[model samples]
Target: MEESDTTKYVIHAHISAEGVVERPDVVGAVFGQTEGLLGADLDLRELQKTGRIGRIEVNITSKYGKSSGNILIPSSLDKVETSILAAALETIDRVGPCISKISVTKIEDVRSSKRQQIIERAKHILTAMFDETVPESQELTEAVKSAVRVEEVTFIDNLPAGPDVLDSDAIIVVEGRADVLNLLRAGIKNAIAVEGTNVPQLVAELSKKKTVTVFTDSDRGGDLILKELLQVADVDYIARPPEGKSVEDLTQKEIIKALRSKVPVEQVVEVPQRRRNKQQMQQQEAARAEQNGKHEAQQREYQREYQRPERPERERGETPRRKSLRRMEERQERREPPKEQEQQPEARKPEPREAGEFAEIMKDLAGTLSAKLLDANKNVLQKVAVRDLANVLKETNGEVKSVVFDGVITQRMLDIAAEKNLEYLVGVKMGSIVKQPANVKVITTE
Candidate 1:
């Protein structure tokens, strides 16, 4: 009992005696009856002396000359030893001259209960006691990817460029090293820099062999560089940042938008040259003003000469002056031709009629849960409910040039439309689309 603190298991039993018995009688019966029943090694007395077993506990109740109660015994012994000792106790049949019966019930392991408590506490500590500032796996992956891409800007022929420039069929030409780094961040690797307004020979040679797109800052310098590159290099296309936005500062979405909206070189050549025309117009206006000033002085002298008081018949014959005035008017008519209209800079072709027609079709189909497929000519070739859009588009040939619907354009539908090579997608709104095709146009009301 004094060594009970080392106990690993507790034994429980029910004791029933035919005759009334006290606690002392029950305890005595257990030891007296079980001693030497198995072997000397498992003797209850020896186990107690060795602190392998604790003192036995007996609770008794007396009613109608009968005793029935429970017994508890603590054991420091192993599993088999404890069970053998508990079973021997059941052999007790007499308690102070009365018939008795003991039934071994159950054994509870103390270590197991303690281990369960520990597990519960550990769960609470793990959740409530730790800092939660750790980022998600996806966020960490994105951060590392961005870092790697930004560091991958390499130099080719002393020009800052991405490593993929030589291998890719088409290359993007930017103004400076920063623009190349920014394009790398957007996962566009085939980019090289011009480094200044003067187009580099390396870029020009490469442009002649491979397709080039000159992307630059959204300012006068960018435009000037663009025009210079246009003359020196074989630019297949031209891409520009949005108004007042730098290419290096554009987000991935904006970068893709600019690149997708790139127009053919033919469509862009006259644009900058129009500014050249404006300069020429300014110079012509200055020359014309100088000539007009000279003409005004001459006119003042001619009027003074004509106003001189009555001259002789020889000086005024039919007014040698009136005929001379007629002749001067004839010379002026011959010198200056008809005043022509000043040429205005031609604007880029208006927005594709397909966009406006799509918008109108979208408005008409709104709230009707319907979709319209149009050919390149803005003629509706087929109309169907929105639910059947995917199946219909799949079954149709590549002749369907555009799609306008009354519902949101989800990623699934967008992919299907793109896979079918549809040119335009006009919807009431757009859903969370992860992949946007560059060739396909997406439009939403809001």
Candidate 2:
């Protein structure tokens, strides 16, 4: 039997002879029986000559003049030819002049075994050599954000705060340094921590100047801190974390939602100056300039409230608050001499018919996110969406007189309206308006 290394399949067969037979007799019987059984394409002699058929091996044992053994033939032929050659091996009825019987046992795929070994070897290499230190994109982003926030956090009045705490028009007051850090991580640059339950005098003064919202955990400590701030500082609103959660534990989304859903400080805790004791009054006192600014802000706030009558339903339970605010306004008024009050000019509001027309247009445009340009006679000169209102108004010559929309009126829109010499502007709500057009009257639905 010849030997060849490029083998893909091995055929095994069992042989038994009527008389004693050796391995040579068994190998010769296999080749000779299957020689012409298949065509020239699969001839065993031709396959062996081309090295397509590997060595034929046999193992035998002779006992009591009887022989039993197994034959093995390796082939690289296609499956159809290999199976046919295997099947033909069973037709051998004699082995080299001896009556013999042969039966095919099994065929093994050499390549399949090699493939399994390759796979197990690859697994070992992967486990031992590959790098596993790479982190996910989200984790990398969080790490970079934490580093940047740590750099931007500053100290205000020796209390931890975001960089913009002193400059922003609105500020958030939290419980501790950790809460301030969390707010900084959320990209809120106007947050400052009180550091404890005792409200600092700086935060109280800031409350008198800028809008202040007290934000804290929803636990017992938070409630006590909120009460202390309400008594000592002029807080505008109160924002609480979720039940059983601390401010530092809130995610960015939860923090934003809590601030957005904040309630007015008066609604959360009503403390009428008329009802407060002398000590509480002393705690709530401020400098004369702060008092003046606070009174003017209150007057403007009440003026805006008077323009929108949506408070009629809420007036029942707010009587004490209303009286308190009224008394404060009267005291501020009496302090200002008659001459200074006369010199201060007030902006004129829209006329009843024109104001009603603007209100009607605003009501009709509700939820539409659209705007309308009106002529002097309340005629719609042009209609555009709120997003394009400023650009469209800028392009118009002077045909547009009044503007009405179902969106919040911003200061930029007001400036554009003033440039266009528009007479009146009306919107669903008014945003922070620092600069008012002296000639143009601005009205809001509420």
Candidate 3:
């Protein structure tokens, strides 16, 4: 066999004959019987000549005038061809004598077994290589340098602050302790956190001594903190993360970019004041226009109420005009009943028992941290993890009558429920949902 034909399959067969048979007879019968079975492409004669099939070996023993032995054939053919060749060997009925029987027992793929051995050897080699290597001097030096640069975190006035706050000429004020660590990682060692929305007194005092740059998140909460900081401290400059990002989450490059883009406190205060003044003017104009409309409506109402002539004193001779007005009033009274009837409210019907039952079940499930979907008859269609509730809600169609989950009811969840025309969402808490759909009722346990 050539080197390329090293990976071949081994076919094992059992052969038996009633008359005594020798090894050569068994081999000859196998070759002659399966020669034309699978056509020329897989013919055992042509395949053996081309080195695609290896030598066939036979071992036989004779006892009591009966012969039985094993037959082995190796083939470099692919799986389908190997299987066909193995099956054809079973058709050899008479091998050089009385009725013979052959059965192909197994066909083993040699390459798969070799591949497993190679994988185990490769793993061993890699592990040995890793174990033999030691850390170089340069790697040790880099490790030491990194350790030195890890600044120690300390507390100042009960707020987390970096080690270089006292020594540095300028300080960066951030929203939380994580922001302080991030800035430190970025090589800005003079960062400190106010810990919360409220500015600490020590931070205000530090602002008076050092050049303080207030770095906050780029959200509404950040703006509120900035306003409070301005009221309580003498801030020099203001920095903010990119829109929709938090200070703690900014990358080193982003942190540097934000710091470079810092604006003077004067500009920050003036722009917001201008915006506030503009908003106040718009509100005042809107209020004035509304008041004017109300005044016009009231004037029209007064005219309608007082323009009618009072009954002329009976002492004076009743004028023809007064008699005509009195008849008109009597006709108007007859037309008012239909309008009053239209204004009366219709009676309300009782709610479905299923909905009430579902609500009760949901109330009992509060704080369970699981989600359940209900059908029209209040049967639970599915129960799922609360974290997967949003995705499940998106894929479900209108068959869902209500969704009860032990999680916060967010606006996104509410919107999806509304799209499916879902009637009720009972949860443990509610998020800030600005625009609630009128068709969906949101209920919270707390």
Candidate 2 has its poorest 10 consecutive residues by lDDT at 338-347
Q: How accurate is candidate 1 locally (lDDT)?
A: 0.78
Q: Candidate 1, TM-score vs. the true structure? A: 0.30
The 10 consecutive residues of candidate 1 with the worst lDDT sum are 341-350
Q: In candidate 3, what are the lDDT values of residues 75-104, reduced to their tens digit?
A: 876555787888898889998967999998
Q: Write the per-residue lDDT of candidate 1 for residues 1-446, one digit (tens) a residue.
A: 33267788889999898988999988777888888797887788888898888888888899999999999999877666787888888878889989888898999887887899999999898689765577675587589988674556799989999989999999999999888988888889999999999888999889867888888875667868887987777787778887546787689999998898776554323223443464578899998999999899779867865776655755556565675577667767888675776553221222666456666677788656568898988789999866457778999978998888876667677788779888888776555456677667877765
For each candidate in turn, give its C-alpha RMSD to the true structure in angstroms.
30.7, 29.1, 25.0
Ordered list by lDDT, greatest first:
1, 2, 3
* Residue ranges of candidate 1 with Cα displaced over 4 Å: 1-149, 270-446
lDDT of each: 0.78, 0.77, 0.75
Using lDDT as the measure, the top candidate is 1
TM-score of each: 0.30, 0.31, 0.31
Model 3 misses residue 332 by how many Å?
96
Clashes of each: 0, 0, 0
Clashing pairs in 3: none
